[model samples]
Every structure is written in C-alpha cells, then in structure tokens.
Target: VDQGHEVHVAYQTSGNIAVHDWDALRYAEFMLEFSEQHGDISEVEQKLYRKVIKFLRNKKSSDADLPEVRSIKGLIRRGEARAGARFTGLDDNHIHFLDMPFYETGRTRKKPLGEADIQVVADLMQKVKPHQVYAAGDLADPHGTHRVCLDAIFGAYKWLEKESWIKDCWLWLYRGAWHEWAIHEIEMAVPMSPQQLRRKRQAIFMHQSQKDRPPFPGSDNREFWQRAEDRNRDTANTYRALGLAEYEAMEAFVRWKG
Candidate 1:
C-alpha cells in the first residue's frame, strides 16, 4: 500500500469459534452496563445482550455458544481485524470478512468445504482483480482452519484460472507462527528493521480480545505477537548463518504456482 499498490485484507471466516465463552460473557456484560448507564443503546440491542449474557452464563464448557453469542464474538474479531487494518493504513472498504458458509457452524469443527465457500472467495478475487494473492499455507495448524481456508482459495483460483486476469495474478503462501518455510523452500525474504518490527507488534496489539491469554494459545504459552517476533528474528538469524546480510527480522514467503 505504501508503494501505491492497492492492498486488501480478507478474512475467510468469522473466527467466532476462537473467542472464549468467558470473553463473550464479559463483553456482553460490559455492553449491558453501558446501555443502562448511557441509555443510548436501543432496547433491542439491550435485550439481545441480556439473552447472550444469560445463555453464556448457563452454557456448558462442552456446548457450543448460542447463535447470538457467537455473533457477538464474531463482531469482536471483526472489530479487531478492522482496527488492525486501519492501523496498518488501510481503509474500511479494503478489509473484507468473507464469513464462508463452512465456518458458520459456530463450533470448532467446521463443515466440509463447499462450492458456496469457494464462490465467496472467488467473488472477492473477481472484485479486486488483485495482482497478488497471499494465502495461508500453514497446514500444521492444530485448529485446521488454515488448511480449510487455503483449500477454499485453491478452489477459487481453479475456478478463475481461465479468466484474463488470472495470468497476471500471483499467489503467495505464508506459514503461521507454528511453522516456517524451510530455508531452501523460501522463495522470498523481506527484511524488517527494529522500528518496523515494533510497528508490527503495535499493529497486532490492536486485537485486544486476543491479548494476554488467547483462547487457543496452542502449545506455546507466549502471546501471538511474541511468537511472530521470535519467528521473524529466527528467520533472520538463519539467513545470517547462511552468509547473507544480517537483518533485525525477516518475513519469509513461498510463491505458489498452479
């Protein structure tokens, strides 16, 4: 975006399942309290919050969140995403939430990838006609959302392969914090300065709901930002060991050819 190229961030799912029930309940309670004190919130909104609070309070740890509660959680994630994007200098119009049908199950186990989900991604590709598409290539994610989302993008890419813009569009695969591309497999390495890394951390900090103890902390107890920073610095160290110029941090990506 800084280079005058258009950029858009698309989230394939609502990410509602990742939000903890306790977090949702706390947010609901806060909203209800705010509504009571300010009297600015609509009656409908207040009633919905009340229902969500009540349902979440009684919800079992094994039970899925109520639809309303799930929606609230989804909203929280969406707001965080938008804030992060804005912090990175993107307009609201450029940030998209596909909320693919397969991921709307409101459970940790999502539905099988279907045509509707692929079409949602395809529609965005058609609309943007982007020159570059970055997809999550992290198949090792414990939650499996990354693999499903990547499959959706692959489906969309195949569906649009005959289009005129397809020839110009390049797909790039990025691994998550859990894994990094092998040194030889990495097609590109973008170096980052200390200042740039600090800014990256700040951008990630926009997701307040994910701060401290994230619902899915995985095996690593460190926060998401810490994981990211460590991963980048480790990549840079690997490059340095290979006799390359040293950098404070580096982001690695592998270009996908289909």
Candidate 2:
C-alpha cells in the first residue's frame, strides 16, 4: 500500500520451533521433564498449549535449563502446535498467512518434497501474479529445511511453466540465518537507513518466542537480532568496499536463473 504494490508472504513452514535434531531433542527433553514432574504425559501437551500464553504474559521460561527429549516425532508435533500459536498471536491486520502443510521433519532427514507442496505454491503464484518471488538460498543449511523450501518453490514454478500459467516473475534467492550471499554473487543490494534498520529490528522483535536465547543459535552465539544486524551491516560494508555508497545496513539477494 505504501509503494502502491501488493505484498504477500508465504511461509513454507510455520517455522515450527527448533528444527535441528539437537534442538528437537532438547525440546522433547524439556517436555518429558515437565511430564515427569507432573506425573502425567498429558501435562506435556498442556504445557505446550500454554507456552504462547505464558510468553504473552511475560512469563516465558529460560531456554538454558530445559531438558532434552529423545522422541523426534513427538517434538515435531509439539513444535508445530507451538508455531501455530505463535504465528496466530503475532498476526497483523496487513499480513495474511497461507495455510501450508507443516512438514515436521528436522535435521535427521528431508521430508520427501511432493506435488502437493508444489501445488500450494503454484496456486499462490497464479493468484498473486507477483512480479518477484523469493526463495531461501541456504542450500547447505545444516538443518536442511531451507533447501527443502527452495526445492518446493522451484517445483511450483516449474509446474506453472508447464501449465503455461506462469507470469513474467523474477525469482530471487536469499540466505537464511546460517549464511549470506558472497559479495561477488550478490545481484541486488537494498540499502537500509537508520530508521528502516530500527523498524526491521522491531519487526523481528515481534517473534518473541525466538528471542533471548533461541533453541538453536548455531555456532554464532549472538541473538537473532544481533546476527541479522551484523549480516546487514557487513553487506553494506562489502558494498562500500566495492566503491558503492555507504549505507547504514543492506540486504543482498541473488537473482535465480530458474
């Protein structure tokens, strides 16, 4: 609306909490511990049900002391439930959330990408007829979900092309938390002013469940906000090094040929 353009976001996954194997295990463990203490397995479900509520009430639990569970499937389900609640709570009047399947698999293995997943995306593309589409570029993400998501988008685009319903859309790939596009590989670098940077940080802050200490911070100990700021600033610096105008922050993207 601000730029006289429609903005729509499609999340392949609801960002079901910690998708890494280790993180999943940690979450499972925590739930198991809660079950054990309450002397009933049902309590585990109850606890997760209240997680978003507790967070909203400013009584979120610290991640450091959570126990680790061995059940991956159980954890995946719990994560999806938690993610749904979190997303619903954070819903804004301007943004619409599409109902996509939550393939609740983590680092252990890849969820078999299927036509259904591709079709969902294809339908969205046909409906939106967007001039641009962005897919995750972190093909080597240790957790694997990013790569899966990218493949799904590719599949959707291919399907649309086959049906002759494809629009003249430009596809862009963006890396996730694990990595950023190399300076030489960047095709588009968007500069962010100080106020824009602050606004971006505030938008990120809305995902309160992911703040403080996320379950899987990876090798980088910094919080998500810190990591994002550093990456954006680094991209800006890299652009400056190449004799571009200095910017407070920058987000780089690579144009995808496919």
- Candidate 2 lDDT by residue in tens digits, 26-139: 454566577778877675576763553343334234332122222343445444444543443432332433434535442334457777777787777888777888777877
Candidate 2 regions exceeding 4 Å error are 19-102, 105-110, 162-167
Query: How many angstroms is residue 35 displaced in model 1 relative to the true structure, after the best TM-score fit?
Result: 2.1
Q: What's the TM for model 2? A: 0.69
Q: After superposition, how far is residue 151 of candidate 1 from its true place, in Å?
A: 0.4
Residue-pair clashes per prediction, in order, are: 0, 3
Q: After superposition, how far is residue 7 of candidate 2 from its true place, in Å?
A: 0.5
Per-residue error (Å), model 2, residue 114: 1.3
TM-score, each model?
Answer: 0.96, 0.69
Evaluated with TM-score, which candidate comes out highest? 1
Q: Quick one: best lDDT, which candidate?
A: 1
